[model samples]
Each structure stands twice: as C-alpha cells, then as structure tokens.
Target: MQKRATFRNLWLASAFIAPQLLLVFVFFYWPTAQAAYWAVTLEPAFGGGNQFVGLENFRAVFADANYWASVGASLLFAVGCTAVAVGAALVLALFADRGLRGHRLYRFTFFLPYAVPAAAVGLTFRFIFSPDAGLLAGINHVVPGLWNPALDGNDAFVLVLLGQSWKMIGYNFVFLLAALQNLPRTTIEAAAMDGAGVLRRMWDLQVPLLTPTLFFLLMVNITDSFVDSFALIDVTTHGGPARATMLMVYKIYLDGFESKDYSLAAAQSMVLMALIIGLTVIQFRVVERRVHYR
Candidate 1:
C-alpha cells in the first residue's frame, strides 16, 4: 500500500497554506461577502444609515425592463460567441490536425491571436469596423450609410459578438487541435479503409468523438463571454448608442459606478455570480459523462 507523505511540522504546513488561504479570503470571500451585504441593504438617500431591504433590490432589478434587456443581450453574446467560437475552431482544428506541410506553423499562427490582450483585440476590431476613417469608412463612403454601429443596436451587438468571438476562436482552436490530434488513430484508419470520405469520417466519427471537448468549450465560452466581453464591448461600443451591447457585467458596472445605484448593482452582481457558479457547477457535474461506442 502507498503511504501518504506527512508534514512533520504543523506550523510549517500551515505556513505553506497560509498565503493561499489569505489570497482566497482577500479576493474571493471578501468580495462575495461585501456584495451579499450590499445586495440586501439600501443606504439612506438623505444621510446616516443603511436600511435592510431584504429582496427589494432584487425585485427592483427584476422589474426593470433595462435589466431584462441586459440579460437578453448577455444571453445573445454567450450563445453567439460559443457557437461561432466552437464551429470556427473545430474547422480550423480539423484542418490543422491534417498534419499538412507547415502545419506546426499554421497551428502557431492560428493560436497567436489568443495571446493578444482582450483590450488590444477590441481596439483593433474597433478600428477596422469604425464607421468613419476605417475600412468600413471606405465602403460607407461609397454607400453613404452602408454600416454604422453607432446608430444601430443590432450592428453594435454583431460587432461585439464578432470581436469577442474572434478572440475565443484561437483559445478553442488550441484545445480542439490537441483533442483532434489525440483521437484514436485505429478507429480513424478503420473508417478510412471502410471507404468513408474525409467529411463523412469527420461527421460520422471524429465529431461525435469530440463531444466531450465540444461541450466543455461550449460551457467555458459561454461563461467567459459573460465576463470577458466587457472589455471588448466597452472599447467597441461602450454598451452602445442605445444600450444594445450592454451585457450583465457591463450593466452592473453602469448601475453601481455610473448610476450610483450600489444596492441594485450589488443585486445584479449576486445574480451574475450565481450564474457563473451555476455554469461552473454544471460543467463539472454534467460534462463528466464519457462517450461510449456501441
């Protein structure tokens, strides 16, 4: 039987873990407790004290049409980014997995975008898609109003989606390519020998085999989009001319900092926190099923 290594000094063991415990308490636990406190307590408008309002702040947020709009926008961003990122990365991974000449170079090039910061990606896309003095400007010059995200909410949302999804592709590509490369070679060879074409083999075999990885990417992309999109949306649209690109996180920022509605923002933060925790829990609990061949 294998024996576990024992720490001789309990104080030394505590010392080793103390930093991590401190960090978790400082960053995670502290903020969570703060948000919970603020979520239920409303400060007096005139002065002095905070009144315990229970779920009133939450009720106010739920009753707000703008908050609901932000929720819808967040949902759209999550779904759109996940779908596009997964699909595009899968296609790129499939191609890279072929091990064609210079495939290593291709893989590096494909994944390089993820190394770029989100704000940089946002700035780059913002420049490219800017209605004036951008590439879009040249086209808009010819058509007078071919594209203007500033004036259009859907356009703003699409641009935000594209910018954020573009960053996610490189991340997803690395995972997918590694997963593709690690697939069972014997099954693929058998498929090929049995006269299955590339597309057919991929569709009928490899993709189904990739189910676990795909679902993982889906959950991660959805959760990350809900948060990471703030940087992109802020740079590209600032939640837009009509609040079209306002995701839940961005809405929280607006409410808490800009509008000075701390209690309401705290409530939104709690909701967003629950959503992210739920997603993480779902990923762990639900994504554990192994794929079986009949």
Candidate 2:
C-alpha cells in the first residue's frame, strides 16, 4: 500500500506560502500592471497627472531612430554576451572537471566572479579599462591613443561587451561544472576504450550529453543579457560614449528618469517586455528541440 502525504492544516500551508505570493505580486505583477497603464497614458514631466493617450506613446517611440538604435544594441548584446560567456564557461568548466593540479584552487577562483555583484564587477572593470588612468591608459601611454574608449564609441561598446561577458562567465561555469560532474563516467570510459581520442570522446560523448545544460544556459544568458545589463552599463559606461552601448533597458531609464518622459519610458518598457517574451517563446519552441535531456 502507498500513502500520500497531505497537509492536515490547509491554513498553515497557505499561510507559509502567502509571503512568497505577496512578494511576487508586489514586485512583479504590480510593476507590470503599472507599466501597462502608463504605456498608453501621457504624464507631464512635473507630475500633473496620468492622461490616457492610447498608443500614441508607442507610435512616438517607434518613430524615434534612437529607440531603434537601442533595440539593435540590445540584440547585439544578447547574442554576443551569450556566445562569449557560454563558450568561455564551457572551456573553464571542462578544465576544472579534469581535476588537474591545483584544480581545487582553480574551481574556487573561477566561481568568484559569480559571487561578486554585477555592479561591483562593472566598477572593477571600469577601473581597469577607463581612458583616464587604467589598463587602456597604460596601453595608450605606449601606443599613443590607439584604443581610447572615451573618444571611440566602438571601443566603448567593446569594453561593455567584454565586461558583461566576463560577469556572466562565472555563473555559467558553476552550472556547467556541476552538470559535467554528474554525467555518467561509464560512457566516457567506454568511448576511451574504443580508441576514441580526447577530442573524439568529447565530441561524441561529452558535448551531446552537455546539450541540455548548454541550452538552459543559453536561455538564461540571453534573458539576463537584456535585463541584468542595466547595472553593469550604468556603472561602466552609463550607456554612453555617445550612446554606443545604449541598450533597451537603459533607454527606458533615460526616458523616464533622465528625460522625464514616463509615458514614453513605459511604452519602451512594454516593447522591451514583448521582445523578451517573444525571444523566450522562440527559444522554447525552436531551441529546446535540439536539447537532449537524457
């Protein structure tokens, strides 16, 4: 006979979960509902009142070329950071999994970045990168203005990309390493016994098994790229060097806080939300097909 566990005090169970539900509603749903309302309404800079203006805000946002630029930049970041972070993490995780000499130290060091806040990582990289007196300054001291991010928009963007990718790598590495450690050792041993070399075994055995983890990381990295980048960009570039790294999320901040255009900001935020949702749906529908879950 089998027994099913049940909560005798339904009120107690509900009470235990009430805090989490309240937090979700307060943080996520409330803000989302407010954004939805403000997106279609115009609000004056000095806070007169919210005025319902329908989709006029969206129309203005679409008409602005700067908004489109932010969109393009966000997409570029989403793809670039994911590819760089995931690939770099895979390499580090593989090396760590081999348990080579000093691997314990290596594992600990590799994961340190994940422990640091993104804002802190951004600050550290900014100190190391900025044009005044950092790594770039030292390089320019010899090269003579070869890679000044302050003067070069492309250079600034590259810095943001590098910093963002570096921050994401530690997070990806932790999960990838855990997944690698759990994979069946018998499969790897059999492949080696069959005369498969290291690369062959990795390609034929390890990588396929790693697909599910890779897919999950891909989704997470992409989603995080769009949302979590605000703090990094704000600290490092402030979406500047002539708006070169102006991502969609940052654009919303500029519109609302800096420019005092709440309605337009809300509209931009809605668009950003839609973009994230659309990408998530596509990833699940298309990308998940290739994920081998076994």
Candidate 3:
C-alpha cells in the first residue's frame, strides 16, 4: 500500500513538472543542440550534398583576426561594465542599508533605470551624448566637452562602458540591497558594541557574511553583460567608430544573422557559452566555499 502511495505521489509530481520540462526541451535544448551541430560543419551545398567538416568552423574562428579583436573587445566591455556596475551597486546598497530619512524614495530613484528598456536606454544615452543641442551638450557648456563620449575610439569605448554600467547599476543594487536588508542585525549590533568602526565592521564582519551574495551577483552581472548587451550595442553605436565597441554578441549577431554566416556565428556563440560555463564553474569551485551566512 505504501509503495503504491509513493508511486502515485511521484506520478503527480511528474505531471505537474511535465509542461515546464517539455518547454525546456523544446526551447532550450533543441536550439542548443542545433547550434552545436551547425558549429561543427560548413554550410552545406544545395542539392543533396553536405559534408561534415569537423572543427573547421572553429579553426576559421581562430584564424580570423577580426574574430580575435571582437573577442578582446567583448572581454573588455564585460569586465568594465561588471566592475563598475557591481562596485557602484555594492556601495549604494551598503549606504542605503543604513536607516536614512527618505530611504524608500531614494531606493525608488535608484531602481527607476532598471525599469527602462535597453533599447530606450541606449537611444536616450545617444541623445545625451550627441555633440550639440543635447542635454549633455548643454551641461558640457559648463563642463567643457564632458559629453564627448563618441569623438574617438577611446571615448566611444568609455561611453559604452559607462552607459551599460548605468543601466545595470540599479539591477545589481536591488540584489545587494536585499541581501543587506536580510542580514542578521544582532551580529552588526554586537560588532558596533565592540567599538568597531563602520569600515572595520564591514571588512571583518559584514563582508564575510555578504561574500556569497556578492559572488552570486558578480557571476550573474558578468554573464548578463556579455549576453544581453548586444541590443544596447546595436542601438547605441552599432559597434561603431571602427569596431571599438564591437563585442562578441554583436559580432555573432552580425555574422550569423546579418552576414548570414550561420556556421561562424554558431562557432562564436559556442565559444561564449564555454567561457560563461567556465566562469560559473570557477565561481562554484573557488568562491562558494568562502561564502558565510549566519
């Protein structure tokens, strides 16, 4: 009787999960499998002649100078956006975690940008940085070329990094703020009673407990920056000013869909997937053990 009851419960659970499992298989696994298959082959000739050219697509990727440049630019963009966004968010979260007047209003103000669509954010930033007759240009009158983020390669790179970071800061802050708000107050009070200054308590007590949340946010922010910034890049600069901000996803978009080189795009995408997977693995291996929560 117990065995029958257990089997019935398992069946009920499977029934409830079936739709989600099927959706994952259809949407995620199927497309991933197709991309992986295409990454190993050249575009097949029409009329019933297709050859499996193993690893040639990836070989071409390695041999292409433009591909390497795009990869480097992508790495730079990801690191820059992640560092700035996460650092700024961490600071904001820590400051706001304290009981300040109008804290709710301040939280809303910071999180407002996260609600803006990425395309809109990019377009808005472009207008702000336009050479003349823009809000930033008006500010530049007093600040002197402060909005010239597109004048050259270096300037363009800086503009994209800052724009992306600004868009991401709110999202990162929300996560860190939740972590901080949920932290145990007893330990913080105890530390304060022990005559620990804010910095000392943060360094010795709070940060140790916050490490897991910080690591998780860092991983997610980096991955999202790499994968989702394609739309922002496309709308803002189109990887412009001589490929200065031509990141990996933008390259994949141009190569696969725009240039219609599906094989090359798939290969590039596989490389990105590998990089993200490796980073996630490292996060678990090295960072997870150090996380402390009481």
Candidate 4:
C-alpha cells in the first residue's frame, strides 16, 4: 500500500498554499493578463489613455519586414543553439557516465557554467570574441579580419549562437547525465556481452532508451532559446551591427522600452506567447508519440 499525506483541516491546507498562490497570481497571472489586454488595444506613448483596437497592432507587426527578419533570426538561433547544446551535452554525459578519473570534479566544472548568470557569460564571451584584442585576434594574426564579428553579420550571428549554446550546454549535461545514470544497467551489460563497441552500444542500445529525455530536452531547449536568450543577446551583441542577431524577445524589449511603443511591444509579446504555446502543443502532440518512456 502506498502512503500519502493528507491535510485534515481544509483551512490549514489553504493557509499553507496561500503564499505560493498569491505569488503566482501577482507575478505571472497579473502580468500575463495585462499584456493580453494591451495587445488588443492602443495606448498613448505617454500612457494617458488606451483605445481598444481589434488586431490592428498585430496587423502592423505582421506587415513589418523587419519583424519577419527578426522571426527568421530567432528561428535560426533557436535551432542552432538547440542542436549544438544537446549534441555536446550528450557526448559529455556519455563520457562522464564511464566513471573516468576525477569525473565528479568534471561534473561540477561543467555545471558551473549553468549556475553563472547569462549576462555574465555574455559579457565574458564579448571580450573573448572582440575583434581588436580578443582571443580571436590571435587568429586574425594569421588571417587578418577573418575573425571579426563586430563588422560582419554572419560572424555576429555565429558569435551569439555559440555563446547561447555554451551557456546551455551545462544545463543539458546535468539532465542527460541524470537520465543516463537512471537507465537500466542490465540492458547496457547485455549489449556489452554481445561485443558491441562503446559507440555502437550508445547508438544502438542507449539512445533508443534515452528518447524520452532527449525529446523533453529538445522541446525545453528550443523554447528557452526563444525567450531566455534575450539577456545573453542584449549583453553580447544588442542585435548586432545590422540586426543580424535581433531575436524576437530582444525586439520586444527594444520596441517597448527603447522605442517606447507600448502597443506594438504588447502585441509582439502576445505573438511570442502564442508561438511558444503553439510549439509546445505541437511537440506534445507530434513529438511525444516517438518518445520511449521505458
């Protein structure tokens, strides 16, 4: 028989959960409701009054070529970051699962990046990729201006993509390592008995079993790459020399705060929310079917 905790008093249970409920209402629900309202209305730049406009702001946003460009850039960033982060993390987790010498130290070292603030990581990468005196400058000695991200659009995109991927690698590593550890050892040992090499075993045996974790991480990392990357992009490139790295989230910040167009910003936020929700739903509907839970 399984045991479960029960609250005998309803008032006591409500009291115990009240603070969390209040915080969620205040922080999440309130702001989301406000954004939803503002999305369908026009507000004065100085915030004196609001006029309800049905889908006008969204129409304007959709009509803008730059908005489409930002969408493209965001998609590219999300895909590139997700692929690189998940791939690198999986490779590292596989090696770490082998119990190499000082594996515990290596685990801590890898996870250290995830613990650091994204802003700090961005700043660090900014200096590291600087065209003049950065580590990349050393490469420029052999091929002058070859590594300059400051002036090139493609280079700038690559820089931000690498920064975002590096920041996420540690987080994915932790999850991958945990999932790998939890997998049944009997299956792995059976594969080993068949004389399967490490790489062969990983591809044939371990990977299929890890599909659920991999799929979950893919959905999470893709969504996170869309929203959570604003800080990193802002600190590193600020959407770059030609808006090459202008992700949708950063565009929302620029429009709302920098440009002071509250109506447009709110509409963009609504679109972004809808996009994330839609993608999540699609993932659960389409991708989850392929996940092997066992």
Candidate 5:
C-alpha cells in the first residue's frame, strides 16, 4: 500500500510540473536550440534554397568591425551602469538598514521605479531629455544649460549612463536592502561596541558577510545591462547620431528586424551568448571561492 501511495504521489508531482516543463521546452529550450543551429548557417533563401555553411557565420561575425564596435559599446555601457547602480544601491541599502523615520516608505519609493515597465522608462526618459522642449531643457534655465547632449559627444554618453543607472538603481537596491535587513543586528552592535565606526563596520563586517549577495547582484546586474536594457537605449538614442550608444543587442535588433538580415543577426546573438556565458563562468569560478553564503 505504501509503495502504491509513493507512486501515486510521484505521478501527482509530475502532473503538477508538466505544464511548466512543456512551456520551458516549447519556449526556451526549443528556441535556444534553433537559434544556436541557425547561428552556424546562412538563412536559406525563402522556401529552402540555401546550403548550410558551418562556422563561416562565426568567422564573418569576427571579421566585422561594426559588430566588434557594437559589442565594445555594449560592454562599456554594462560596466558603467553596473558601477553606478551597485555603488548607489550599497549606499542606499546602508541608509535603510538604520532605523530612520519613515524608512519603509523611503525604501518603497526607491524600489518603485524597478516595478515600472522598461519600455515606459525608455519612452519617458527620451521625451524628458529631448534636444528641444524637454523637461531637462527647462531645468537648464536654472542650472545653466546642464542638459546638452546635442552639442557634445561626452554629454550624450553621460546621459545614456544616467538613464541606464536610473532604471537599474531600484532593482539593485531591492536585493541589497533585503541583504542588509537580513544581516545580524547583534553582530553590528558588537562591532559598534568594539569602536568600529560606520565606515569601518561596513568595510570590515557587513561587506565581507554580504559577499554572496553582492556577487549575485553583480552578476544579475551585468547580465541585465547586457541584454535587457536594449529598450532604454533604443528609445532614448536609437544608437544615436554617431553610433555612440550602439549596443550590440541594438545592432542585432537592427540587423534582424530592421534590416531583415536574419543570418547576420543570428551570428551576432550567438557571439553575445558566448560572451555572457564565458563571463558568467569566470565570475562563478572566482566568486564561489570566496563568497560567504551564510
């Protein structure tokens, strides 16, 4: 009877998970397998006219200067956004860890932006910082032309950074604040009793203990900036006047959708996948050695 019950339970468990398994196989695994296969071959002429040429697509991807430049730009944007967002989140998390008045409300306010749609953020920011008749243009009256991306290359680059960081700050803060809140209060009090000032406690105690959370957030943030922030850049800059903001994903989108070059876009996407996977593996290798999960 017990053996029969165990089998029944296993059947029920599998039944419960079947839908999710189906969805994963249909959407994610199948699409990934197809894309990877497509990456190796030129898209055939409509109605199956072309032959499979393995590795040539990858070779072409490597030989393309524009592809390399777009990838470099994407890396630059990801690194810059990660630095700003993570640093800001750490500071904000520290602040929220203290029992300040209306702290919960403040935390909610900071995290609210993350819940907002990325496409909306991109659209709103684009209008808010337009060359003419934008909110930023109005602010220039008091701030003495503080928003001028039109005339300066450096300023435009900075605007992209600011937009990306603004969108990501809340997302990082949520994870960081959770980590801070979960930390041992007694340990912090003990540190204080031992004459450890705020900075010292943070540097010596909180940070070391929070390494696992920090590493997780860092990986997520970088990966997000790499792939998910395309909407923000697409709406704000459209890769911009001189391709200053031409992230690799944007290039892929342009090639795939805009130019209808499926083969080229597939190649670009494959390269991106390689980059993300390689970096993630390296990060895990290094971080897992030191990450303190407890």
Candidate 6:
C-alpha cells in the first residue's frame, strides 16, 4: 500500500507549489505563447508594431531555398553527433565498468567534458582544426591545402559535427555507466559460466538488458542535437563555408538577429519545436515497443 500525505489546508498546498508554478509561467509558458503568436503575426523588425499575417511568415520560410538547405544540414548534424556521441560513450562506459586500473581517474576525466561550457569547447576545436597554426595544420604541409575547414564546406561540417559529439559524450557516458553498474551481476556471471567471452556476453546479454536506457538516450540525444548545438555552431563555424553547418537553431538566430527578421525566426522556431515534439511522440509510440524494461 502507498501512503499519502494530506495538507491541513488547501491554501498551504497551493502555497507550496506556487513558486514553481510562477517560474513555469514566467519562463516557459509565457515565452512559448509569445513565440507562437509571433509565428503567425508579422512584427516590424525594428519593433514598430505587430500585424496579424496568418501563416505568411511560414509560407515565406518554406519558399526560401536556404531554409531547406538548413533543414538538410540539421539532419546530417543530428545524425552524425548522435551516432558518434552515443557509440563513443557506450564504449567508454563499458571499459569504465570493468574495474580496471585507474578506472576512477578515467571516469572522472571522461565526465569532465560535460562540465565545460559548449562555447569553450567550440573555440578549442576551432583552434585545433585551424588550417594555419592548428594542431592538424601539419596535415596541410603533408598534402598542400588539404586541411582547411574555413574554406571547405565538407571540412566545416565535419569539424562542427566532431566538436558537438565530443561535448555530448560525457553526458551520455555518465548515464550509461550508472545503468551498467545497476544491472544484475548474476546474468553476466551465468553468461561467463556458459563459456561466453566478454564481447559475446556484452553483445548477447548486456545489450538486451540495456535497451531501456539506450532508448531513453536515443530520444534525448536526438532532440539535443537539434537544439543544443546552436552555441557550438555559432562559435566554431558560424554556418560558414557556404552554410554547410547552418543548423535550424543557428538559422533562426541568423535570420532573427543578423537579418533582423523577427517573424520569420519565430516561425522557424515554432517549426523546430513541432518537429521535436513529433519525433518524441514517434519514439515513444514506435521505439518504446522494442525497449526491454527490467
């Protein structure tokens, strides 16, 4: 049986949650409502007045070829970062779970990246990949003009993708490591008793058991790849080299702030929000069926 606590007064209960409610209203709901309104309305870029446009902004967004290109770039960025980050995190978590030498130090060092700011990580990578004095600049010496991300569209996309992936690995590693530690040891022992090697045990036993956590991470990583990469892209590539790295989030910033098109930016932001919501719903409805919750 579950025990329940009753408040002596209804007002007291309301008072307890009032602050949190106020915060949500102020920070989340209010801004969302404003964005939704702005999406459908035309507001002067210089803040003169708002005129109800009724989807004109959205039509304009769809008609722009650059918008479609941005969508394609965002998809590539999302897939690349999610795959690399999740794969690398899983491998590192597996090794860390083995109780090997210096495991504690390794775990600490690996998770440290999560604490660092994304802007700093982007700047660091920008320098590391710079064609002229970067650590990778030696590659240019070996093959003339072959290592310049600033001038090559593919290289720019790759640099942003790698930077985003590296920053996200630590976050995925922490959760995966915790999930691994909590898994049943008897299952692993039984597998070993049956002559299953480490690789076989991990692939056949541990992976199935980890499906729930893996599914959760997949949803989170995909959504984050769409939204959380704005800072990194801004700092590193700024959607340069023919807009190869201009993700949806960065495109919104570029359109609204740089181009001074508030209504268009708001429309794009609403579209992005809808896309994330639709993807999350699909994941829960379709992907959740395969998750083995123990």
For residues 63-119, write the lDDT of model 5, one tens digit per residue.
Answer: 988778887888788889899989898888887877689898978899887877777
Instruction: Score every model by TM-score.
Output: 0.95, 0.89, 0.87, 0.91, 0.86, 0.92
lDDT of 5 at 257: 96
Candidate 1 stretches greater than 4 Å from native:
1-3, 291-294
Candidate 4 lDDT over residue span 1-294, tens digit each:
555976589899899999999999999999999998888999766757788899999999999999999999999998999999999999999889888899999788997788778898888888889888868878888888888777898888888888889988999999999999999999899989989999998888877878777888898889989988988888888898788999999999999999988889999999999999987997787554755432
- lDDT (CA) for every model shown? 0.89, 0.86, 0.83, 0.88, 0.80, 0.88
Q: Which pairs clash in the backbone of model 1?
A: none
- As for TM-score, the candidate ahead, 3 or 6, is 6
What are the runs in model 5 whose C-alpha is more than 4 Å off? 1-14, 44-47, 138-153, 279-293
Please, what are the lDDT tens digits per residue for candidate 3 over residues 1-294? 246444558778989999999999999999988899889877665635445889999999999999898888988888898899989988888888886897898788887788888888888877777767666678677878765656567767877788888988999888888988888899999999999998788778877777787887788878888888877887878887788888998999999888898888999989999999998997887564654422
Best candidate, lDDT-wise?
Answer: 1
Residue-wise lDDT of candidate 2 within 162-269, one digit each (tens)? 888988898999999999999999988988898998778766778888987898889889889899988899988888878899999998998899987878899999
In TM-score terms, which candidate is top? 1
lDDT-wise, the better of 3 and 5 is 3
lDDT of 3 at 129: 73
**Ranked candidates, highest TM-score first:** 1, 6, 4, 2, 3, 5
What TM-score would you give candidate 5 relative to the actual structure?
A: 0.86
Cα miss at 20, model 2 (Å)? Answer: 2.9
lDDT value, candidate 5, whole model = 0.80
Q: Give the TM-score of candidate 2.
A: 0.89
Number of colliding residue pairs in model 2: 0
Candidate 6 error regions (>4 Å)? 1-3, 44-49, 282-294
User: Candidate 6: deviation at residue 118, Å?
Assistant: 0.6
Q: Looking at candidate 1, what is the lDDT of residue 238?
A: 89
